[model samples]
Target: MDKLLSLCMIVRNEEKVLARCLDSVQGFVDEIIVVDTGSTDGTKEIAGRYTDHVYDFTWINDFAVAKNEAVRRATSKWILVLDADEYLDPSEKNDLRSFLTGLDAGQPLGISVPIYNCVESVTSGKFIESSAIRLFSNLPTVYFDRPIHEQVVYRDGELPLRSYPLSIFHTGYLDTVRKEKEKSSRNLNIFKDLKGLEEYDYFTLGNEHAILKDYKKALYYYERALTKKTESMTIFPYCRYQIVLVLIEMKRYKEALQYIEDNLKRWPQYPDYYSMKASVYVNLGFEEEAIELYTTALTKADAPAGKDKRFWLITPSLGSHIPLMNLAKLHQKAHDFQKTVYYLSKLVTMNVNDHLVLFQLLNILVPNESVASVLNFLGKIFDFGRADHLVKLLHVSLLLGNKELCEHFHQACVKQNIEMLAQQQLLYALVFNEPDRFERHLPEAGSGSSTGPLNKLIFLAAIVWKREDFSSYLSPSQDESDPSLELLQSMFATLFHPEEVGVDLPFDVNYISTLLIDLFKMGYYDSYDWLIQQYPQYYFILANILGDYFYQNNHLQLAVDYYSLLLDQKQLSGPGYYHLALLYLYQGETAEGLQFLRSAIELCSHESHWYIRYLKHSPATEEKKEIARQYRDRFYPYVQINVVEQLLKGQA
Candidate 1:
């Protein structure tokens, strides 16, 4: 006789995905046991289609109790526990059947199947695989443990377990599903009643709070877990990792570093601790130290024969790939271009589908190559990914003066039927600077209006062309073109007569910056002045572009006004301060200029060549020279100020 298997599950309002889970195992399982705990939806009706063993259970707010109740009704020799959102792959059905049939009839055993928890990220989707003992012999002693995040265990029987390559795809963690379920809040409420039961329970509480972004609360519970004196804790490493992560989230770098240092002797082989230490070092501006720590992490992670060869779920990839990425960033920060490329190339091989990495590679490589080489490289590497990413590639193609490549990409866009109206508008208005091309992609006359990517692009193009009839093209009548265009009419109203429009609506700083740059390029001073005059608060974006534009065109007073407004906005750090300082010096405001110049050097000493040069030329008393020396010493350790000083002297 063939061995029988019963599918046992407890569900509530899982009507949406019930059919899918049931159909995957309908042919294999002998009996289907679904215990509904008060479902108002078509869950019961759907379960009825699968099997007659559907039973209703009372709500106890205890997952283990409900799960155990479902399993108790199973009559088969073997039991398979599953959730509503989880299912075995259809392709693995035959293999699962074969494995179950081949099991020893005399043995009391279970199989640890891999559960691939699928989650969709901004760019792509990936699975986080974990092991769970879902299949077991139907013994009365074998049952689930805990109220939430429950696990399968046996009471008195020694259920020997073996691993299987079989996987169950889990969708409960998906953002779309989780928003409706709010599982973390539910779990948190359930955990409130079950606190102080075990050290592992404290860890789960920390995880729940961490998901809710309550890092302070999370840290408190994590510390509580650490305080628990257990002889041998399996989750101790994970607990340490979580504590460090929470500290980092709070930006308590000093506390985090001290914790890592204190624990280094105890958990020497854990790569994530080292990774956390490197992060703290980076935040503190200790670049060299960060690089060394990141390197050490990579070494430990890749070691073939290490004493502690265990991997934990909390930071599965920290030891493997994140270290390399961090190392790459540190090299990039230190301006070590070749080393940056080397690490990034390694990352590319590891994550071939990473468009951001591919884009970064192009950014670094394109500047050093000729137009033909860049075009050839783009053609060889550019695979159709996100539309926004492909748009950026087109912009890069235009920057390299490869019109043919741009046209090729345009043809590809048309072939793929990808709607990239914003990109096409940018290509015309910004890259090609052709009014004809800009006008070609405008929305049809009868199409209704709303604020969207395409409509925003249209507004940008209209301003660039200085089209007299642009308002007619952007009719306020709500006919029907783009849904997101309604909020942007205030921005567009200020286009022709900015002084007349109020600054109640918010406009994208980036979009405004691009528009300001274009208007400055085209010498449309009236329109540019109107825009800045209307929205005085968002002057940071306008001021930077206008200040530089006017400074380059020798409009010193106007440039000073724009730059001074930027300074007034508390934006006087790094490049903004440096440029404002130079402008003040040009206008002969020596005292005011020197203060701004000092701020620039203090913020980023690596780019302090000109500031140092100006200080050297100015009349400097002993006290002023000492102050200058202090500023230079504080910010310019990595910068070759002496080399810059010598070069300036030689020029003089």
Candidate 2:
């Protein structure tokens, strides 16, 4: 007898994962029809191992044509079409087999099967499922049309169809190995050729362009598709969603907001619509509105209990944590210590991994009584085997003047054999004004070790500055004849005036300057001034550091002059421009500050790292706020600035 169910597939170069898919459905389906369109890989050879009904067809520009051809070759009563990257779970296969047996007894014209799109290897792999029609009768009553998004065309009479509970594990969208852009590019060319085919065809073309990351072209096509007016109102929202996504990508948040408002007015039941709306508010620096929408979305997820009957409807499998995380991030950015802690506590209650959330919380929370509380909280949750987290925790503890906590974390780090932890521990000792602890750790550094003499000398300088013992350390080091004396002199100059170090260690220049500031803040100005005079080359560094110190201390004009001198130095570049821009902001020269800001932005645009930091730390004034906004909107468009706004407001 003929088979009751047939598995139809069209593939090219899918040899890597095709066997796994075929093996998944082997026991459930009775017939397998594999169609190949010029695959040079061993895909055809592999397909022969599974079935005898393998056939080749000429490559066509239309996917629907290829799929329809594959479906026509099925010799069974029912056809189930799937991609090579898709598979059937064992339980789902059993469900399908049972459904196939029932269909054989009384088969419908078509059936809709559920498809699950799963994102794996993120925080955790979980399936997000949706439904689509993939199974249908092979009778002449049902046919497919269009090159893409082919719909089931029924005869003018009442057609029989059923929604099956069986699900297909769809990996096609999640499979990142396949070059999606190449596929989209190929489809886009075909779409352009068939521009006037139909309104639905134009929408498909727009989707194809959107997938290819050609937002401008995608927007043009989607607008043209909307003009057709032949498509249903329900279909209009999907096109609008795509258009809004493109607008967001282009940093056209205002236009995107309008599209979202129109979409929500028509279909507020769509959960994704609310999520997109929240995203727009985030882009436009409107955090309160975004949070309101997110809270509404969360309420919709849960079934209504009390008299609040006006909540929006939400779909299943859409988790509330996605928006909650965004909200927490907003609070953190605004430096609202209490609210940041509150959100983090809520996140932990939701069964989130507390370690991750707590680490982020520590980064945002101001160092104080809460710092000790957070450190203790972290110790209770995660193991110290992770050196990075332990080191970070140690840094926070030291900053908060929690010596006991710092010592405890330092012991944990020592047990973990973390090299960087030792350096951090030394710095911590200096910061806390503990000379005995610093002396004890000083001898631990050796010549060949990663923690070497140079780092040790820097640490000692900081410790001496803290303890007012610089005279003892620098007494013998003033003699110019000894090699160690020159080393000491250069170290003193570099530590206090890093601009003297020149181009050999460009990155290290900032490191030295930061150490000098710490020493100065600890009241070691006498040694700082001596080093500045001895190493005249470091005059620029001293000037810049003093400029920043004065600015922070509210001596704005003096800071401006020092920064100007640093900028005027010959061959000055990176640090020079950055410091000058900051000084201009302090002096209320907003236009000059922006000019320097733009110069810094251009200089660092090609740098792989630190570019974001460079842009973020540059001061913004009311006169230059528009310039700052434009730069942020252009370069870092993905960041949600309303998050920053919400944070600032919460802090206020």
Candidate 3:
């Protein structure tokens, strides 16, 4: 077959990801030409496995020079430029072939492939997408430009380019990779040493400085970029946005607000500006203005492309999800439950795959709504027939300790005949408090290299569960042991094994939370007070979990301990107070109980059934009746809800 596309890449010390990148485009690209600029690793050898057209080049501080060297060696109609850290989506290889075949290669055409730069883990779906002209015709007139932040250009002028439906995932931007490679420092040095810096060059410098947390330098360069000829730069808006972001990072929200407002006038069609302005308003304590601006942002953020070529939509979510999230949080803080759910639910619909969105929605719904109502809401939003949705529901339900809902999701998963992953099995076992299921999946689930800390926590759970002979599940050493797990181990030793070490908790919130739930499950009331005393900081975080768990389970004394702690720390919610009040009332602590109930009624919803419940728990006093009547305008709605029977037909 005559070569239609050639893959050109310049690399050094990319042995870890080189083969994977090459492997992705193996049969798709007609030829592969890898230019090695002094790799001290197996990069050359790995490139050799995929192609014979490997060439060596002397290391220059110039990326363009190396890239042009690689491009000069290509012998094909089209050039597909890639970095060693980037790869085409293997499934989309056919689309690339079709795209190349259909294009008129003789024209000054270039395809701007969206490069998804992974910020954290490449597999973690955390990435930023920027369109780059990575695929272009291999004409003699075409070559690379710039020493750093290089781009392909015609010898005469810029090439005509358009966005395409193809993806290239890059991992070089990841924190681990950035730290190891020090690429930011290299780029910064290149920009610093460049003789005649341009607008784009200044922007690149801003980016590098921002990445290094040198905000002062970043803003200086970004301001310099704006002072240059930015009329043709597609990254102008990005540079502006970066300045705002950096200002936000530096807590200069007022200054950031000025910039955002100025940018909005110049680029009013841009939704991200509105979103950024909203954020500034939030920081400036203009909550209502912030909400209104966010709502405005939502209406305009759905443009399929940038308003003009001089802009790029660098942020994926600033348009919709970001504003939605901000609105949800704002409303939540305002104690407007309905508005919070409304925004979060909208977010849920938009981002079906976003676990955090769905989790927040669940958190809002689960506490306020009935189980059946929550189930219906889930059904409306998610197709539980899908294994992924079911799995998410199951995970969140487990987190919420809603075992009945977990069981429902689990059964639905089984009906779909989905074989649970090891982690899923562990989650299931953990939430359901199923020791046998935990035993069944522990080995495979515990064996992962990165799961050592989690596995140790699981090992501690096994101890709590009194799993016989779980020594095999323990990792060989505590080399990877979490301090949280050790704290748990110490707590266990102090309580059950009195001859062992005393509790010296370097308190870990997550593990302590897990311990509370586990102890609550075990009905080990003795452990509760000890946990509370050992970790005074628990009042802020874990105390609620402790209070809710004990309260919901009707563990009177344990509930009293945590709820009282919450009260002492001023951490108790109205619902929390209601639970504690009930506990105290049941225990004949009448004075404190009545006072707590009154406070609950005062702080909680006007529509709260607690008003009616307060009325019922009487050896009725005039004061209690008067309080209820005064606060609650009508008992009719409440009594209506509580009644199970219909009025006799035609009785009225």
Candidate 4:
């Protein structure tokens, strides 16, 4: 009488966890039938410790077939199917031992066991228990089918399988959700190749699609799966979630509200349902309502049992950062700086690596003269290697006019060979009213040859405009034909006047222009005049900068002069005319501004239509009444205003 139970398992590369799993059940089961389906790890060697029934089977695409093969190889009266990442807790092992002891003398079928799935928490790095069903009967009366989400199908002609309280601890799908996603994708491709995939196949495909973030396709498949008339409400709620997610992605917030309301009507305790509702409210700019929903989600998070009630469901993970960050932004947008600072501070505590949170914190905290507090908080939580944090610290120091702190951070950046640090250092020098300090580092701007062209431009822009005199660096042969010169030209072209180019440049040209414009806008008249006279061909690049600087700094007369110079230039182009129109309107010369705007409309043949609309609606020009009529009659005939209107609406 072979008084034994054979443990069956199908495995691949499970070397990292196979030993632990086998050890957990080795005492309860007599013979372990470890079925290897092309495992390239030390899994076979590790499996040898518990049993000698290890055998190899060629992998077919169908997992059900592989599992069935494993069941057939067992020689004992009872068989237990397990995975390489699954284990039996001590209590579960004792339960199984007791069940086996009391097994009917002639019993051939097995019992279903409860499974507790544990996932590693992304925030705390701890494991939380979820639930599933892993234990099942080994008798031919019960079989599994389906290519991907294989279900245990019981044959119609046998005693009903018994379910026990014995629970399996599943670590297989823990941090490996990403890997399971890949497996699902592979299964999807296989199902797609088949002649006709059933409704179940569509559900599995939808699950894979949802995991991959292809929400529209996921919704399509889910809707199709729903149409199959399945009675399983378990899959229905998940499908609804996927549909809501798709609507969210599509930015159909108003439509998604109905779905959320319907979902809550049925499953009121679902945490993710609340999270989705909150997300929709956030998109619709209902910040107060969104916050309320999120608060409600926090209360209901722990209501669900099993796999759905993990840390991700209860406490916010990295996924929840966006909503919290948005709420902070909303406070900032509403001019509630204190609330903005408070929320940003909370976000920084959650994850210090989030540069956006650090930026927002600096933006709010520095304006309120709370730089020291922010710096101290950041120092406590963040490691020093984060370049973005260092940059933000330097920015905050500059904002507070603390040259000593700025210099300290600048040195740290230099020591770390962070190229952006050089740019930040230059900005720090300029902001603190110390141009000489920036000039001292000018020669070393391009010293790091490996630094990208964009970084070098930032360095050069800082030095050239910040220095007291522009004529000192003049050379007859400035290597104007060099690739670096072209890059510089392209950078300026896209930055100040994007209408001149058909496509946007791949670097931060606006930042470089901003730095240069700031120097001229701060009453550096000599430098601005000298650069304009020397680089007349590049004058259009300086026009917007000059106009913006003067307009912002209350030097409207100087802004008028720059705008006039831009209008006089033959290479002023379409955007140049628009800027000139804006400046004239700003200077109370509405009629002249309207004429310049009309000229811009004529030049709009090669420019984006949005620029034309901008010119038409510009209050800075006096000719809007006439230009509006002219725009309707003359330019509207050639321009695709409908498409341009849509693009304008999108921006608004």
lDDT of 2 by residue, 375-479 (tens): 566656555678766776666555444556667777888888865544454667565666676666655533224433335345455536543333233333222
Candidate 2 vs 3: which has more lDDT: 3
Top model number, lDDT: 3
Q: Give the per-residue lDDT of model 1 (tens digit) for 536-621.
A: 77666667766775554445577778777767777644666766776566567877777777787667766534445355546645
Candidate 4: Cα lDDT at 403:
53
Write the residue-wise lDDT of candidate 4 on 1-652 in tens digits: 3745777788877788888888888568877777788888788888887778788889877788888777777776676777777777765666676777677635445466655555453332223233333444455666666655676666675444566766576665453655743665676776765656666667768867876677888878877877646545335555666677677787556557778788778767545667677666555334556677766665564354446344343223312454556667655544466777777776777766555456557644543465466556668766667887676566555543455566677787788786554545555656555667666665564454433433433434434454224223222223333235445545444434556666434343354455455445333446445444534444566666656555434455776676666656654556557656656655677677666767776777444343444443456443544444454455453233233233223221
TM-score of each: 0.67, 0.55, 0.74, 0.49
RMSD of 1: 9.1
TM-score of 2: 0.55
The worst-scoring run of ten residues by lDDT in candidate 3 lies at 642-651
Give Cα-based local distance difference scores for all models: 0.68, 0.61, 0.72, 0.59
- Model 3 local distance difference test score: 0.72
Sorted by lDDT (best first), the order is 3, 1, 2, 4
* Candidate 3: residue pairs that collide: none
Off by over 4 Å in 1: 1-59, 69-132, 157-180, 227-231, 262-270, 306-316, 375-406, 409-487, 497-499, 502-511, 514-541, 545-571, 574-652
User: How far in Å is the alpha carbon of 638 misplaced in model 1?
Assistant: 22
- Model 1 scores a TM of 0.67
Candidate closer to the true structure by TM-score (higher is better), 1 or 4? 1
Query: What residue runs in model 3 are displaced by over 4 Å at the alpha carbon?
Result: 13-28, 38-58, 87-129, 156-171, 302-313, 368-372, 459-463, 466-510, 517-652
